[model samples]
Target: MSKPAADHYESLASIPAGSSAHRDLSATELPSDGDIPRPVDLGDVHCFVQRHHLAHHTVVFEKAAIIVLGETPLSSVPGITATELRALQQETENKWKQPKTLYFTILVCSIGAVEQGWAQTAMNGANLGIPKAFGIDSNSKHDAFLLGLINSGIFLSVCLLGAWLSGPINHRLGRRGAVFVGSLICLVSNTGSSLSLNWPQLLAFRFILGAGLGINASTVSVYAAEVTPPLIRGGIAVSWQLWTAFGIFLGFVANTAVYNYGDEAWRLQLAGPVLPTIPLLLTVYFCPESPQWFVKNGQRYNLAFQSLCRVRNSELQAAKEIYSTYLLRRAQSKLDSREVSWSKKIAELFTIPRNRRAITASYVVMLSQQLCGINIIAYYSSTIFADSGFSAFGALLASCVFGFVNFLGAFPAVLTMDTFGRRSLLLLTLPMMAVTMLGAGFSFNIPADRPAHFGFVAALIYLFCALYSPGMGPVPFTYSAEVFPLSHREIGMSFAVATASFWATVLSLTFPRILTVLQPQGAFALYAALNIVALVLVFLFVPETRLKTLDELDHVFSIPTRTFIKYQLTEYLSWFTRRYILWQKNADLHPLTVGEEYQALVETDYEEEDMP
Candidate 1:
């Protein structure tokens, strides 16, 4: 209940009540609380409303002031009784009782995910036939390079240009508008892919398709994160990965359905992605724009309040969120008022200590997402299965099973992501993933004449998919979306997605030749090694972000990377060894104290303020 000094309110109080300055505080200079900053607490919300005279704007602000400050009891709020206050508190307790519109927004976003997954994996079935139809001999080195290039063209475009375009596009048009544009581009590019007369034509259309995929990948997760409540944010935000897995499953089903089409099978496979884009295009406009986008982009706090009201169950809840978000944004704007250009924003990603740590964590997860070797199977599982002793139809069938298992695997994360936490899931699953990849690879060494050879290879690959789906698949996008401060969210996500895309491009472009040269066994072994490396990077760098609100996460990422690494090595490692490895019954592990640095900063500030 403590507030900042009275002098802190002078600048805000100087602004004329009901003037535009009250609404657009970004243009006004604000007093800073020295170099060391603490997390934005509810007191800041109370102070802002009181000093800025914002209570006159709407009843929402008046109610928010009462609720956040607790200066006046619930009985004093105009329309409320104690029962209504209890009900409002119950609403917070029940995170699943979200409004229908929130789910609808998630559905709209999920359709975009379906479009991405379907388009991304449609090539798995097509890979079997594209080389033959294009008259490129897979045996020849140059033709294989051509094949890899064509296969990876979309991802190449994503890393080079499309991902960079997301920030400006999302800023220009709102979240819904960006999704609409991305979906439309996907529709055109996917249709073009089906009509391609040659490999060059196919490559061109796929490259165009990357632009759409990149934008959606960068925007959708952030959209979901902004709109979702903190209690359920992890589960809901991960729907992007869940529906993507479902889309992958559907892609395989489509490929299997068209397997008998002979020369035309690959064409139909490429076109299969175009179906999901239709729903996404038609339905996106109906969903509400991200409320946080309203505040960050244009300082339209009233609109943000209205938007939150649509998604939240009660006025009190909506008011609380909008007020908190506004204060946090105002605080962030004060911290870095000079971030006027995109280049400077990008530079701040590395230049600012907190932003740099977030970037490092995001980069580790995103890069691991690709380097963990999921794409090796995702992009070319049909080819891998075919080489593992299955017939053409048999290979397609095996890949279809892989997709199904991948989809099934994603559901557990929804149940456990918040409870188990992102970092824990990765740590729990990565070693298993490494073992499965290695097992799948070594299974190829079994004699081709034996039934166990095919059985073992397929089973191990399925297990690998099961492990990857819940952890690395969902965590990268979800973590990247939530880690950055609201002001930097768009460009920060773009950078993270670009990192993932760059590695994915490398993986897709190289795996064909890796398969040809090292064979499936050695190739899988290579990825298994990379997965081990990924596990180490995750342990050393990635901080736990589970269950923290977007604003509260400012403190989480503020902890230095070296400190995180040291904790993992000195504290967590010892605890794990005692509790899990050694099976000590009484071993107790301490939670990482995120607020220690903030508390230290606070004590230092108080000491300075008390100086005579």
Candidate 2:
């Protein structure tokens, strides 16, 4: 019997045993043809990989045309020049560095974060005006509950409802398309809210708006994470949080300026988010679909390769990244061998240990984001400031201060996030946050008549925002965005966002009542206690996920849950030492530094042939 063409191609592409494993590799992992009996034509490498299942196990040049001289074997070529080799090396270097298209896409997609943030706190200020415009009596306890239900209550409920809807939207329209639809929904809802003459009309439109932004919230972060290189992924992915804080800052600025406008100013404040949405919709039209999404949908060449090239920056980098994408497709294809229903696929998200852990981690991180009490400050800071004895304008100014400090907080996050890594920062910040919340609780216990005491409270609040900025504020969203497999990234993030909003709604509906019953000090103390619980959750459940590719993570989480602690400690110590050295050089002198070993970043845990 004759050997098949596909099998022959696989043999040609396979690396030799003598070559260094990817973990110990010195240069590009692509080996020379020293072990081959005879050379194969260079022009056919991509075509063979595109059609051959086994060819996916090794890296190959994606663009055959770039090699030129179709009949020549790369190793046997007498005509190849130093310039051609240098051009290839330079292209690979550019791809290894940040590519413009990838960064631009990240920037444009981050506008979704801006819209989400704008909506989140806009109502915080609008609450002052909207209740008055409707002539609703908010004097009694019942009215206060109704007011909470109208403002944050409805928004968060549908926000979660929208998150569930995002799965189908991403599956159907893809991540970019889902973002566009969600942004349009934001524009329409914000426009409708501005024009709404009655409270019910505003509530209805806001509900729709929440659903739209929910879909966006679920999509944008993953869109950024999937497209970024592993080395710079954390820094770039954290842009989602940076822009979100900026949106919150802008919301505070707008609300402060319009506080004097009384009833109508709320309309302009509500409409503010639409400005960012317009540009996002315009630009996301040009951004590529996720390379994994393309491949999983069975596109082997065009869309998948192009998107991978844009995101990974060159054919070689794209080739390396696409190995994981190809593995994902191979896994999905195996499941397709039997008649796998949609319900089965959904079940696998939990039944598969790797995915199950990811979902659990995402839920914990997200719920912690809300339960840690940051949103209470973010969504109701003006209210919080008012209760602390500020005049209405003074309250707005204090909020502007919070917004400025909050914006400043995100700057340090971007710089340290990749270098210091996620787990170490979380461990440090969670404790710091616990202390700050405790201090704020004590501030509430101070007598309101003592204006001198107000400065202490104000200082605590600023310090809290400053401390919160670098870690708890951004890391959860950034982590959740990167943790899922490409197949589940959309729905996984939706679940994370939805879980966060669910808790947020719980606190929003109950917070005003908590204040009414417990008063300010008691409520602040309650938030402090909850933050402590959130810290415990982080300590126990979350694992370090720095410098890992998404597919690389598939192996780590696949290990039994019992082993999580060892990995967590290992990653933390690695970055802690690096950061300690930096701090020693820059700040406090500590001889304590990381003496560590990392088995290279992109090396796969599973053998090449062991994939589905």
Model 1 local distance difference test score? 0.81
Q: Tell me the deviation in Å of residue 300 in model 2.
A: 5.3
Candidate 2 structure quality by residue, lDDT tens digits, 1-612: 011222233433344422334222311222333333433344455554657442552344433332321233444335434544443455446534566788788878777888788878788788777777887656568867766776664448555578877777887888899899888988899899889998778878878888898888878877776677665666777787888998999899888988888668889888887889899989997887887667655555456666877765346546545544443344344333455455665676676565777877787788888877878888788888888899878888899899889988999998888778776687778777778778887887778898755787788878878878898888888888878876566666767777787888888878877877887778878877887888777776776777765444754555444445454456644555666755544342233111121123224322322211
Q: Per-residue CA lDDT of candidate 1, range 507-536, in tens?
A: 988888888999988999999999999999
**lDDT of every model, 2 decimals:** 0.81, 0.70
Candidate 2: deviation at residue 421, Å? 2.9
Give the TM-scores of the predictions, in the order they appear: 0.87, 0.78
Candidate 2 residue spans exceeding 4 A from truth: 1-99, 135-139, 153-159, 307-342, 549-552, 562-612
Counting clashing residue pairs in each candidate, in order, gives 0, 1
RMSD of each: 6.6, 7.9
